[model samples]
Target: MSEHYEDDKSRAAKASFYHAYFSLKNILIGSYIVLSILVISIFAVVTSKVTEQIITEKENRAVINSLRNIDDRITLKLDNYGTVMNSLAYSESTQTLLKQASELSNQRQLELVNEVYYRMNEVNVTNTEINAIQLMDLSGKKYTLNNGNYYMEGLMDNYFESPLYDQVRSLNGGLFIDYSGAYSRDTNNLTLYRTINELRGTRPIGVIAMSIKKQALGSILFQDSDLPLTSLIDISGITVIDAQKELQGTESAISFNSFTDIASSFQTPLYGDNYFITYLKNKHYDYTLVNRAPIGSIYQDVAFIKKVNFYLILFNLLVVVIIAVFLSRTLVKPINELIGLMNRVRQGNLNIKMTNPPLNEIGILANNFNEMVTTLRNSVPLRKEQLIGKLLLGRTADSGLLQQAKELGLPAFDSAHGVAVVEINDRSNIDASGVSIDDVEILLQSELAAIHSSALLHILDARRVIMIVHGEDEDIVPYLHKMLNEQKNIPVTIGVGRFYASAEHIHESYLEALDALNYKHLFDRNGMIYINDIQAYVYSYEQLDVLEDGIVHAVKYMKEEELLSMIDKLFITFKEQFVSKEAMNRTIVNTYLKIFKLMSDRGIDLFGSEQSNIQVPSINNIHLHAGAHELKREFAAFLQSATRLIEERREKRMNETIAGAIEIIQSRYADNDLSAGNIAKELHISENYFSKLFKHETGVNFSQYVTTVRMEAAEKLLRQTGNKIGEIALQVGYNDANYFSLCFKGAFGVSPGKYREKQGN
Candidate 1:
């Protein structure tokens, strides 16, 4: 309406610029002429809008196609450099020098260093785009080859930091290119960072940096234009490259920084004339390519044609003026009827109808307009409700919705906005009688004043209620909690979402409320939870995955003490991080189930004969899982029973292994080469593993068991066969008579001769 008023005022000023004629003939002629001019003006305005859209699309397409072609060329060039860098990365000798340049001897290093320099020279010859290549250690200390012939850089602070280098490090290992000043020495040159890793491992051992000079970049960097100036702007809006060296003043006229809300593709005005602009961003390097040309240059031919048509229309208007007078009278009659009907509609009435008056386009238009008015009147309430729903859900189109909301007088949504979720617990379910959902909503709205509420939106259900509130203070969350806590009539649980500054984030607040409500069991006594207080614990809960894996490993290995330590560690972390009680219960139960699954996969059962008397509680039984401490006690007992069963399983396997080893040893006992190592080798077990199992299963060390078997054989030979000590020693597996007599005496606490005499030989 304001725009319409301004247009009327503008026309009134234009009419005052003309002289008035009072003669009847001239007045009638002038009035018809003026009316015809108004129709022609409307035609021109509509034509201009269509032409503007077509021309804008045509120029934007032409410029963007050219920019994309240039972008593709640059990517191709950079890809070649990347391929070369990857080739050098896979070179085994280069990788070895990167890792152990300090470990090589001086003479060997010099010779090896010359070979690397020769290789680098060969690479430089192959790829001339590479201006310089330097290899630095992981600690950023530069290593020179052939006295700085190939690698010449010294230490760089913070391991070569710059805009591009920071991007490369954050991405781990990739081709890093910078038209921006990632290199300190030369901003004109593009810097490259290629992280080189060990040949056989994924560990990055060093970085190789290459510089490509701007001279090598050529005019292609700026698209090499002639008429319109071309420029390459960095991310910081600095013009780094200019194609038209003659038009260096392009910077003074156009500054992208002036348009902070610039779109990816948009036009900007320069000196009151539109400059057709297109946007192309480099996906790899992250700089914007802007192609700009004046709108006049693009539409010059169309402007000439429009001027010719306007002159022709003016000449025709003189001949058509008399005929237009008759037609205008006919057109104005139905239009007057339309004006009256519109006035009725503007006064809030849509029941008026258009009778069958004429068989022309005007009457048909009137009929369609009448139907449209009726439809709008019938759908008013439904549309308003839909808009309100959109506003509450925060799914509104901002400018349009905000304007409509203001006209409809919706509750203001601004900085201090929060959401509260109410859930009916067992106590609440038993006592929610005689209270309608509407009554509850009214109660909540009335109670919101304690929070200094300005507005509210609510959805109530039998089991749950969601309320969105707006307040003036930052203490809105605490006040809402206080109100809900003081409600003794309803034994409900409340979850309050954190406040947000805009209505668009209201959905985020609602999601927070829902998540907080999921942890209701955590605050059983308080019956309320605030998202901000436990948000950190929600993130730290992911660490439980590592803890669960540790528990599984200990349980699988039958390490009962280690398993207990892991459980304590899990609970300690939960306490330290202040993880909610619900989260703790859920994670522990999940981890315990995983432990049982691993044991079941190994064919160990918790309900087997060994565990028949043990009864594990279910998840719904809260008495057994009041908190982490109580849960830990119950879990420890279950783990102890599992450990005993696992130990029994291990013992059976250990007995079979030990019996097999003893059989192999006894069969070969008389052989003097028989020893624990040989016995373990015959049994096909690791020596260390066999020793531990032997000692654990037999209650004696490997060597001690072997010696006893040999000595017993020696005693039997001495007592039963009257063999000489030397012969008995040789029979038993000792190498000499003195050694055998010493062994026999060591076993009997006397010499072999005395033992033989005492046996009455």
Candidate 2:
């Protein structure tokens, strides 16, 4: 009882320990999971925002510095061009040429043109970025030199409607720069127009318009940029010059008028969705130097960074998983092993040595556990014997006796108890093997151990082992009876007492066992003789004569099993509850006298049949037997002969029964829990006897037959059903799909799922 109680306690403890262990494991893994997600999210968001900030700030600064530098240099160049144009326009040579070109002879006009052209060439030497220098008069006459060519294109077709003519016509001083295309066809050029005035009267004479190739000016301003195009846009939003010629005729995507009012550089969308712009405005000229590029091209650097970050995160995640697994195993393995060792100790394996102690708290615990087990090993078994011995003898427990018993794995329950005594018969008289009965105790302990049950067995004397039991009773007494009866040394018998409430009443049960043990003399064979079993068979002496005619009638019909059952009842009454050995022998002889007289009245021959060993020993021989076992052997031989006659009656139906058993196996094969013993019970047959006939008729054991039937069914289901493999496995009575797959593969060389796929279903 104490053993079982302690077992339950240990089981509960183990359950709680594993609960904590698994919970802690999940928490640690979950922490890593949550932490990894948080880290990745935060890292990605922070990196993206910071990169955007840096890119914006850096791009802004670069646009400002590049535009400002270009603005300063271009402004200075324009001012220089203004100074040179003024110097040329007020020259005495220019007034002389303009005045003589219309008044002089053809020869003098040609000479005057040569003189003006040479003057213009000198101005070009000082300002090489000038593309074409032209002079136009109020009378529509024109003088032009392009790219410092001596053979210049003489142009001045119409000056009245040109922006250069109108803007310069209003300027009394300084240059008027026109970024708008000089002509619709010449879109890549812009003109700076300055009006030439009479120094004497301040009257405008002609407009000197310079058509500068915007590329030359842009090259000077934007030499440092990697951007594809940098250009100057006029107040009218027309692009003057671009490094890439594609935008030469295009209008500025951004409005220069909006930006010209600002004191600093700024950015805006340009060309709609295709481009972005950063611009610096020259308010003096209303010519903005703008840097524009495609958005995708600009963000290329950032995209590369994002890809690198993603790979880095993947590498870090892999490291985290590896470390998580390593740490979990390192921490959990030792504790799991310690738990394993502790369970072994709980299960009464005192010799098990706990191994691989770690160097921390668990190590200290391991050392303590080893010391504790060393102490328990020396005392537990001996103390258990003493504890049961004192209880069964009805001795009052001394102070701390209960505590000591509990420490040795006994529970201190106050109720529900019983006892059983098993006696090993003396083998000296049997001429059997010489093995000592005490040596069998080791084998009994293992056979009696249960999943969570407890009982204590003690050897009380040379031939008796007493078991003090508590809690539930199932097959303990019966299994012990079987083990004892099958012992090869000699006949052994068991006697079980009735269950009694109250722990202290176990002594009463112990006494009852002793009384029941004395009834063993009636059995004449190894068997269990429960007190209740004997009570069930109790009868009066007057009943013996009445039973004799019935017994003889059963024997005449060869009802062997029925007749033997009656004898068992009569003997239990005669020996266990009522008569002494001598009185029992007298009653037994008188019972046989009635049986023989009945046989005589029927005129049946008492001699044995030649077909059977149906011989009755003389009454003197039965009376002279030394023990119940030898006397019962004589009766058993007589019963065997009668059983042969019954077998003759059964021979005709033997094959039919065997075939019926096969049908039951086939029909029940789909039940995953089916077994041979349960099937025989349903068929109303003894399992032990049914097993032999099943094997003989089927060429396989019952379990093997069931497996074969299930396997065939599983194949049919796998081929025909559209169900999933795991679902089909369950339908065919396999609880585990993987095991079913393995078995199927072993039989058919293909897994169920693969086989179904092959059928194209």
Candidate 3:
């Protein structure tokens, strides 16, 4: 009984497997599930290999981007420091106080010192990172201004002979940065020093030093919170800043002997951990930023990502299997229906239609099929017009057009015919007349029916109408003229071409008509022009040459009135001389090109305000104009703009020259030979022109301004310094004390001694 039961179960299982193999839905589901598993397995293996490489590459890019950002932050902070130091060193108040500090009385000196302290305090309050500001005079006296961190040691007795002074003097009045701290000896503080010089001379007046808190800079430099180590290192591998306070001013933990460029990365072992190191050199400073991360930690992150990816892949595989099963059921029914409908269409059943369909790709397909059938039904009517247009354009064979025309129940173009091209003078006129080109085409066809009775009209575009008439040129021209006279209110111009014997040659006449229509701009109003009737004149290229010169000269000198008048004269000349359209266009285009070239040669960009390189205008672009009037209008506007640009350039040049002359006068006013002529020669300009320009721009003559500057300096020295009359005179650019007294008397209405006495000297 057991053997019999086993044989029956095996037979039943074999029959079930055969049924599943023959079933389409079951077979599709099974095949998809198996294929999905195979594809997913292969993809997971490949992705595992590729993800590691991609992670490494992404890590490299992230490190590089981090270094770049840190570099920018550090440089910006340093520039802010430089700006503060510059303001303190060159301020007029600071300069005057420092230069006159030693000469003032005990009480007056105390008052000036209070004023200087107030200004420096304001600067420190504005820049919270500043620790303190120190000033050392040429006499070895030092003054300190504290923000909030106030710790001061007395000034060195022999400051002039100290190493700090030597370093400051070595830079020749330029700024000096002491990264190791000179003022406070604190590793957290960096000092910036500047040698204060007289405004015009190279004599050192004093030294100004400012100490900045490194803790303030650390806020921006140590932004890599995830990294194990981040530090700012100098070229000598000394750590200037580090995330750890104790590490500051110590040697960098990573060696940089292999780095040769501004940015570099490598793998190194540090403190028994394999670290990936990336360092970027600051372009404006003597520092390199080093970032170190452990290789084991990076792989740990990659391993976690792999675990998450595996789970996601497993979940996605389940969803894909479910989707495959559902799509197989939903897809087969609509696809089968689509195939049946397409079969009917292929068998020439244009009447079949699909009833309501579900909103999906299948529905879109059904709707498209219905639309395509309707379009085929309507296409027959349009083919006749399409063929006719092609025939007029010579794009279709004449024989092919004849056969199609007979089938569409239209007249065959088998006889002599000529083509006329019609266009509105301006599209703007169409709007002004409250008429569309379609209405105009209808009116034109009605007028043509009365003259030729069998003419066909086609609108090529919004601006043009093409007409085909089966007749001789003599007959066609008269009919076109009559049509033009009847449609006088339409604002349309027509050009008639000579007749050809057959339709194949119709485009030849069409082309000639287009050429003839170009001359219609010469007429005062809309009318008919004939190809044979156009008279060619000896339009002078020499005249165009003269016009170009006139345009350039007018623009160069900013003569707007002359530019407009010349353009008007050229158009009038074209009309009076009966110049052919080609010759007229040539003259205008040549003149335009020459004008732009002239601006370009002078290093002027007419279109772009900030463009330095001259861009040549394209010749082909000129032909895009609708008609002569548009070209003429644009030409006039271009000339006006050119004149405006020239005016702006001249004004800018004059301002720059005046500013340069002022700078030179202020710097050299103490020289005895610093006259207007000498300053003008130094600036590489003519003296007479420079004097005139200076007066025009400054509202004062060059010599008068120079004298004013010198007198002001003399007044300051007389009041501030205890000097002899001869010494003060020479200091203020006066050679002799007697002459200085006379000029000073003229300037202040008092002698030098009297002026000093008036000031309570």
Q: Cα miss at 132, model 1 (Å)?
A: 0.7
Local distance difference test, per candidate?
0.64, 0.65, 0.70
Misplaced by over 4 Å in model 3 are 1-50, 125-128, 154-174, 182-184, 201-203, 223-228, 304-761
Q: What would the per-residue lDDT of candidate 1 be over residues 1-761, giving only the tens digit for each residue?
A: 99999999999977765535455667888887787777666555554565555555645554665565566556656655664565555555567667887898877766655666666665452344555666677766554432232222432335555454566666555776656444535555666777786653458888776666554554555544522454566665655555655432224355656444332456679668898666676656655566677778777745854664465347546544643575466556776787788788766566786676455545655655576576656755545555554554455544567655544455556566777777655544545465655555666667666545655545534556776666454355455455655654555667878888777877777778877776554455436777886645444554676577657756765778878888888877775676766667777777778877876865676676866776664657643443455567777887777667766766675687898887876777778888777778878888999999898876679777777788767756765897778888878788888987887677656798886775457
Tens-digit lDDT track of model 3 for 27-122: 788888677766776666665666666566656655766676667667757766765665576666668667887776878766665666766765
lDDT of 2 by residue, 419-499 (tens): 888777655754356556476566567666753457678776567788777757546777666765674444677778888
Q: List the residue pairs that clash in candidate 2.
A: 2-410, 2-411, 4-454, 524-628, 524-629
Ranking by lDDT: 3, 2, 1
Q: Is candidate 1 or candidate 2 better by lDDT?
A: 2
Error of 1 at 172 (Å): 1.0
TM-score, per-candidate, Cα-based: 0.36, 0.34, 0.35
| Highest-scoring model, TM-score | 1
> Rank order by TM-score, top first?
1, 3, 2
- Where does candidate 1 have its weakest 10-residue lDDT segment? 146-155
